[model samples]
Target chain A: MSVELISRDNGIVAVITGEIDHHAAAQIRTEIDFALERQTPSLLIFDMSGVTFMDSSGIGLILGRQRITESYGGAVAVKNPSPCARRIITLAGLSTLIIEGKKENKNEAR
Target chain B: MKHDNYFKITLPALSRNESFARAAVSAFAAQLDPTVDKIGDIKAAVSEAVTNCIVHAYADSPVVGVVEITAKIKDDTLYIKIRDKGCGIDDIKQAMTPLFTSKPEEERAGLGFAVMESCCDKLKVTSTPGKGTTVTLTVRLDKKELA
Candidate 1:
């Protein structure tokens, strides 16, 4: 699986493309973390539209990213998650932190 | 019951090894056309087992370890075993608890075991404190059980 980063002034968007199974977890984690740390955006959006596969490790990646973003008083959002990816995210009960939409929910950070 | 076509792969005990494990099992399970949900579950179980090996088993040590994965077709069922000879769990019960993670700093949801349990027909975990942990999962083929 491959991950691409698009940094914006408002937030840094991570476009994760490929199968996010156990194998891709570590590298994805490292790249995302580095991007988040370097950009330090108030919001981090993960675009999973291109993700064809995902598992529990993907859930961990979301949780880990959320924790890191929240630590800096920032928030994380997941946008356009594929059907399969959404199922796993919802199964993990992480919908509270990660949302689906175009406009950002600014209130969630508080 | 005598069966044929079994495969075993030993992956490096690293965080990146999960993909290999998942692919190996997915290839084996493809004959069943397991639903997307079932495939996801299988991958999840594999992830939990591998993650445990990477984060907890080999904790801080650079010593390379091995995660042995075995897949066998028996009696219309696919059994997958993931074994890691790293730091063994002291308390299986506590370790299996939902959201009970040894490392909170890593932002672990601690739902690995729960996810694995949800994904497979049967999930069994056997661990020796100093020896290692073995996670055995059985997924009954869809047709035979359905019929």
Candidate 2:
């Protein structure tokens, strides 16, 4: 997976792409966690627009980020996740933690 | 719905191993005409279970272990078995607790069993200390059973 970290005025935005399976989890986790710690933003938004497949590793990464951000009294949210990604997040009871944007005609394969 | 077809696969116990197993089972189960969501859930849950085995069960063991996965279709239900001959859980109750993990440094969410329970119709886990652990997962494939 590829992760792009954009530092906004208020928070850090992480744009993740590719599959979030076991192979991708290790590197993505380290990169995202490093960014979160270094930036220490009040809000962390995960742009999962490019994620095609996500298993439990993705869920763990989200929850871990939430825990880390919450320690700093910050908030975390996700934007524009694919249908399959949304379903997995919902099943993990993370819909409340992350705000999803309105669905668009993108990443329909997922 | 009355007959059962079975297949078994054994791979090295490693972190990236689960994805291959999930892909194999998903492709096999699709031949049974299960709903897309059902297939996805099964694939996800199976991946979590198998990954857990590779991560926790075989954490420090130098000796190689096998991760066994079996998929069978019987009576319109899909049965999946994942076995790992690694460090067996001493307390199954504590192991099943959500958010309880032995290794937080690994960022183990401890949601493996919870996800499996939420997705499959039935999930049974049997473990023997120092022996091994086996997880049996079953999901019905009825058209009306899926969202």
- For the second chain, the TM-scores of the candidates in order are 0.90, 0.93
lDDT tens digits by residue: candidate 2, B1-147: 256788999999876676788889888888678877888888888887888788878877897688999999887788999998989999999988877788777777777788788889999999998878999999888865555
Best by TM-score: 2
DockQ of 2: 0.52
What does candidate 1's lDDT look like per residue over B54-136, in tens digits?
77887855788889999887766889998988878999999898878888766566877887887789999999977898999
Per-candidate TM vs. native?
0.84, 0.86
TM-scores of the candidates, chain A only: 0.86, 0.85
User: Which pairs of residues collide in model 2?
Assistant: none
DockQ of each: 0.48, 0.52
Alpha-carbon shift of residue B70 in model 1 (angstroms): 1.5
